[model samples]
Target chain A: MTTSTLTHLQTLEAEAIHIMREVVAEFRNPVMLYSVGKDSSVMLHLARKAFHPGPLPFSLLHVDTGFKFREMYEFRDWITKEVGAKLIVYRNEEAIKQGAHPLKLGVARCCGALKTKALLDALEAGGFDAAMGGARRDEERSRAKERIFSFRDEFGQWDPKSQRPELWDLYNCRMHEGESIRVFPISNWTEMDIWQYIRQENIPIVPLYYAKERMMVKRGAMLIPADDAGNLKPGEVPEPVMCRYRTLGCSPCTGAVYSSANSIEEIVAESAIATRSERETRIIDHGSNSMEDKKKEGYF
Target chain B: MNTLDKELFSAVETALLRFTTAGSVDDGKSTLIGRLLVDTKGVFEDQLDAAMGVEDKKGAKGAHLALLTDGLQAEREQGITIDVAYRYFATPKRKFIIADTPGHEQYTRNMVTGASTAHLAIILIDARKGVLTQSRRHAYISRLLGIPHIVVAINKMDLVDYSETVFKQIRQDFTDFYTNLGLIGGELTFIPMSALEGDMVVTRGTQLPWYQGQTLLEKLETAPVTGKINARDFRFPVQYVSRPQTEELHDFRGYMGRIESGSVKVGDHVTVLPSGLTSHIKEIVTFDGSLQRAFAPMSVTLTLTDERDISRGDMITHSNNLPRVEKELSAMLCWMHETPLTPGKKYLIKHASTTIKAMVTSLDERVDINSLEHIAAPIELKMNEIGRVSLKLLKPIACDAYANNRATGGFIVIDDFTNMTVGAGMIQ
Candidate 1:
């Protein structure tokens, strides 16, 4: 922290903390959506700070796709224990049993089935009126104009066109009986900011971010782990390669890039010089498709 | 070829700056944002491909840069921005959040939403058309919202043959009009550029060698943020009172909220507003540790020496210094709902964690944005109209001028029955 001034990370942190405090104060049942990523770590930290000297009022909700990196789960459990917060994990097991993996069902269909559907189901089951997502405006073009308190209807549909006017610090927590609001605290934070903040706060993220000698394979244009979750198509081959992930999602769907950066400072310096966009490595956001479609289907 | 050094770029400043773009639809607000985002490399390749694909299908000339900002499906179908879309980008110098509000005259309420939290407002103008009514209206609204800085961008310079004379004339007209409008304070800068030809946006173009000013990006990077850093009297609007009577940390009474203004250290004499109960700050608590001093915008818990019954809606400030407490408030209300704001109508007014039932006593005057004249004795204000309205609150509210501090003075009106936000109010 600067002596008298706040850096951009601190500013974003303050804004997010303010939002979280508002959520717990206004909403009936608010949950913080934890994806066990760097953004989620920063978000959890801010949420903790939002209500200090006392236990956090909200529970952590992780929409389990059942195909995450093994290290991510372990790290998440450890963090939950350390923070002494209850985590309510949700999943759509029926869809997974029906072969709803990304490789089998394709990008939108599979993400809609496992990620988006699971979240909507979880919200319905938990009766949560408000949810906090680590959704940043700089992450995707479609999210650029999303309201901080984005409204979702009974069917969990997000209409980017018709959103409440969030003026100044006044966020509308007034939702209908079944409707909910998806609030993003880190809406202004960029990828670099997340990495920088992680380094500053020493946020313990998954090991997949740092380059290591791990089992890997090539899929079309992306480098994926050889452990394909039993959905490897015909003619696919497995091999060992040194790589790291720019983003972490399901193992089969998330692409890994070749890198040597291992520490937070190294990754920050490397990511700063990296030319391609962070989402360029993810297959779901590839092609002519945008995340707005998935968001409209309630993909937090 | 103005590529900043890699080392300089890597040591990027994390200071954030938020600004709003305002103008009429044809003034190219969207195009300007797209150009800035694209030039800053904020747009990914795939996103650019989608926008280019849309342009190709339309057989449009150039890259159709506005597609980058007009993101929603309806916005694409109508070729207009309907909501306030936030766009983000960063230079090695700073990160920027752009409140890209719709430029249509009907969306002035949305413009207020975008500009209310903004530190600066970039009012775009078509050099060929000079300062139009919509341009003046946007500038007036931004000023009313207390945006500390203003940038009058004379856009579409390419269409006017890159004429310096046209840029100067528009700048002079805006200065004269704004001075008449009494928006004389704050820093005002003018620039001539084309969002299409990329004359003086992110990079300087050879076509505008006569325009000897920094590019828009440079001006934004160098704009002073220190003015807002000055400390004021302490004012912390109570968001919640935490009493986590636990085993180890018993009697942990704390008032939680982000400081609206000023700084507070331990042992400072403070008064809870509307209550005026005197106390001293005992501790400033955060998740990480205790803070010796906390400043504005920092969300922290402040424990007082006395356990006063402070709950939400009560504000804490310096004992000697207090904001004006009143029941009747005169403010500029930007009508947001379709139902016209009628006098003697009851609504819920929410301001700084305080929600109270209030009635619109009278509409003193409505401004004709086009003519800059006040329509006296207006019965009601329709959607997107700005009017001076007096509100009688059921309970007194402690507030500073919206110009003095937006966090304490800005408010919204919700319809009593529908709960829809009907208006955005700035206390005069």
Candidate 2:
């Protein structure tokens, strides 16, 4: 019997696997940047498949902002244990002590210290020369031009104007002593591709991605989780509403959409007809060219 | 999920097409892409609103479609595309990935980066300008990169009264120019339309009623997807050796790599190159299960019937069609760095799962982008310059001509000191 051609998903899977193996072969110290999101879940799964019998040769680094939803933390711990790979979770305790919150310090500065700086610190401490992330080009405008093996200077800065010319599937992973490369295996995948792959692979995701009755309070255009009802201001109250997260981040910074589709298949259906982008609900991504600014500042 | 959603997912799974578009800013490349996205409902409401904000600030009528693609802050400030930006859209028939490359002379490296993997190249030409020098340069680069199909989009037809004569003349000019390059066998197509008026892109509008050719989207959707290689030779470069060393799989020694081209089956005799050892394919493995056979672009592991000394940088092929084993080869090199490529200097050549020290023995000639002429015996190739050169590798690599197989034939030149990819090379 003649063998049929591989599907688009299979093609994507093979490309991701090839990239993972290349990093492992080339870099001395490599790690997976796991954020416990749907993209991260798929990435972690691909990592497992990349080296099936052998355990993951690299560790997983999660830069915790100390502001994620409780369910996300639980899922992170569970999956880490399930995959049996070493997980490195780093938090900026100094920033937390200084009260660096999004509301007080603004989203940009807050993310600078808690996220970008923390990630750099983690990589530097681990002495990792290559860090693989799930950042896709379809997520944002600036990302659409990024290379699969995005090079970062000693300061972890991404210079859009002076990026190396990448061609074909032959990625150049060479770097100097202090510099590191950010490898995005799924750089070509779109948002719809991620959801459908999750459905097809039966990847486990956080419960918050599914609709449920939760205590939510309307904050401007976004609906944020009101876990502590006592923090409500005068004439502000928390109400039970059906909500799900299109994308996940810090609970305070991420907004939930009103939805009734509680299953993966339903999420796929909803995502196909989605009129707004997944990042529109992200509170930190506001203002024109803010993502580029943050990315230049070394945010993942 | 409903029946329609299922059908949509199945369609999305069927195939993926990647193409690149090249044109100067005046040629409306970005506008054509924006029109395709908008007409296909790929653009979200918020994205359109953002584009509208930029358009309103510029005092332009309707939405400025070009603003949608010049995504970077610096690009928006300068009103020029600086690099390759990828865009995605899908119809029920197939999905498409667009590599939107800039058309300036200095950014030829970026255009090559976009066209390197594209199956088709869409070279946009302003109808009024006819075939320009920049257009010829882009078409030449697309041909150099071995893109299987070429679509010459004669845009802005409305400005020329939608005349069929103008379209045919441009097409004739391009065909003549392409023929002078001594090229053969690749597909060439031409279409006349106006992206601003939304004619002959995604929808067939009334203005283009005189044309009988397929629209741009139709050509992209129905293009051939596979078996473009010159020979069906199985070439698998060993990437990583997977030895689990577990309790049950203690003896499980599998070689992992992607099948770069051709196909392989179980029980087939294969030879490991550079080592010259032979073995029979015992099993083809994946995370899901074992496969009886696998084809190009599929990543899998193989268990040999006999143990052989094989590691990364080694190649597996059948004896019937073995790739050429070469220690020195000639190639067409595109210098991508500011530092000129000097002869007799050692650089790292990363080709097909292997990195070896290689030195440029000589610079034969540089191609003049403007005239398409060969300037003989260039001492060194500067940035964004293409030349023919000979290289001596420290070790032998099993390779093929770039025209035969891109995956096995193309490589990148990395600087030893800076570790940067400074040049791209295709074996001659």
Candidate 3:
């Protein structure tokens, strides 16, 4: 490899590592928000690399919406076991008991209460001063304006118009009492980069990402995976089909694509040629301004 | 991968650069990013499949490379970047993080956010549209943000028949404007390319035979970005105080911070700012081990020989090369909020690692972007406008001229009531 090329890679890695270290040093009670998605998996892997001879200094915080795919749980458990990091699952049992499914209360409200609010409650309960997320700027419009060290008020609200100027990587993680920051080390990474890194690093992921024979039902333009957690309407019928998920969210909200790419290499190849965005495949974002509205309410 | 590949990957992983692309709409910034990714072979098969499907569904011709960057549904439907989209790509040479910022005037705040940490700025200009007001504004902002390098990409050459005359004319126009703005410093390179046709993006196109210059990818790979941080002034904003009461290492007191500028070594005499306390650097600690010397941008904990009252928000610097410590300061400010910055309004001012209450004393002059004229006696600084302002701090701050040190010279104003960032100011 050319010296310049090697230098460039070194620079990116160093910057990311520095940011990760800052997250650990700045926040008093910090936690890593693990979603078991490809980005989070990569984040977990990078966290391990950031502190090489030792275990991660912070615990993993997962806001379980209670409607997640079984594969996600398996992946989450497996990662926690492998990393030996403390895993704290935050779930709003009240919302689940209230029958706040996607069909009943809509994807936005369900996610707001079950996922975003649950995470906020967890942070409050645990007195977490900072939470590290795998949110990339390329994901959405509101996300693009996010700072590496995004400050949240006591209410865990994100004010897009009034974001701190994070010049020269000198991030100000200082916040008032009861306030916190949402740190993103991979804010610069895109979807393609994530896939490429996953392929190159050979990071372990959930099997739901790979195509397999699963019971599915066509809904609108998406292929909805039929699972025990997903409730079927009167007109909906499940059929056996080969499918895989581009993004993992709630089982009912996350849609599957018709494909046969089972391996990491195959997934990378398919990702290059896929027409829809990873978010587009997810049924949860079908609502108008769902993701944006969720983010405003302190969702990562 | 072999052992050599593993080593190379490790090295590349260690060194990464974040850059932002800025310009007015129709400058082909998105297309340029698409070309970069496609040319570098960063686009995987799944992504390609999705792009092809979108192209087919929309009945659009060409590759629709912009789709790769326009990730949002609204952005795709509108055919304009509504936000700052970050795209990452890695070649065998280097890994890059590209902040693809929107070119619209309304999203100026987004541009600032993206360019905040960028080492370089790729300012795109449509060859047809010589030098627009927005282009000038972006260049000024890029310079104000203290990006080390600037690459002026003259895009859409195919629309102008790849004319050397057009490229030269545009370059001359930009050079004149930048000269007048006093913002064109560091290694500035001008490249002509057609982002739509992929000319001079990854590989030099044969069509531009007269333009004998490196391709966009080649230039990015070979660009000199080594001398970023100022080596004269050592500034470290203490983030935390690490005191392990463990058995193995009792009485271990280290001040942790990422080096913002310059370098620090063991036995170097350093002075803590704000308190004016002096001490010697006993050790430079890292996750791996202690280092003999640590430079800017490296996050390490420092063990001082003296047990001074050093804490977060306090800065440690070379005693001989101390920065100006004052309560009152002057800066060039950009108003980013809808609410105007009024004089005497108390706000929270955040510098490197410190946050203190501050109030605007006076609005010296407002800059008219189009005419590049200073409007004296402006009452309020509106959104997306630049002005010179004086501020009085409730507490003293140690800072340097932005031209000398970016880390110490910048600050952001936050509303005390709402706690929203209202404006960004650079010390003059």
Best by TM-score: 2
Candidate 3 vs. true structure, TM-score:
0.80
lDDT (tens digit, per residue) of candidate 3 on A71-160: 889889988998788999989989888888988887778878898889999999899999999988656545656788888888999875
Candidate 1 residues A25-53, lDDT tens each? Answer: 89998999999988888888887778877
Share of the reference A-B contacts seen in candidate 1: 0.65
Indicate the residue-level lDDT of B359 in model 2: 92
lDDT of 2 by residue, A204-254 (tens): 999999999989988787788889443344677789989899999987788
Q: Give the winner by lDDT: 1 or 2.
A: 2
Tell me the DockQ of each model, to 2 decimals: 0.57, 0.72, 0.25
- Measured with C-alpha atoms, the lDDT of residue B283 in candidate 3 is 90
- When summed lDDT is taken over every stretch of 10 residues in candidate 1 chain A, the lowest stretch is A1-10
lDDT agreement of model 1 with the native: 0.83
Model 3, which residues run further than 4 Å from truth?
A1-30, A36-59, A65-87, A94-114, A124-130, A138-142, A150-167, A170-181, A190-299, B1-14, B41-64, B71-82, B105-107, B182-184
Q: How far does residue A281 in candidate 3 sit from its true spot (Å)?
A: 8.2
Error of 2 at B324 (Å): 0.3
- Which regions of candidate 2 fall more than 4 Å away from where they truly are? A1-4, A229-235, B1-3, B54-63, B227-231
Of 1 and 3, the candidate ranking higher by lDDT? 1
What's the true lDDT of residue B176 in model 1?
91
- Name the best candidate (by DockQ): 2
Where model 1 places Cα greater than 4 Å from the true spot, the runs are A1-4, A286-290, B1-13, B54-62, B226-230
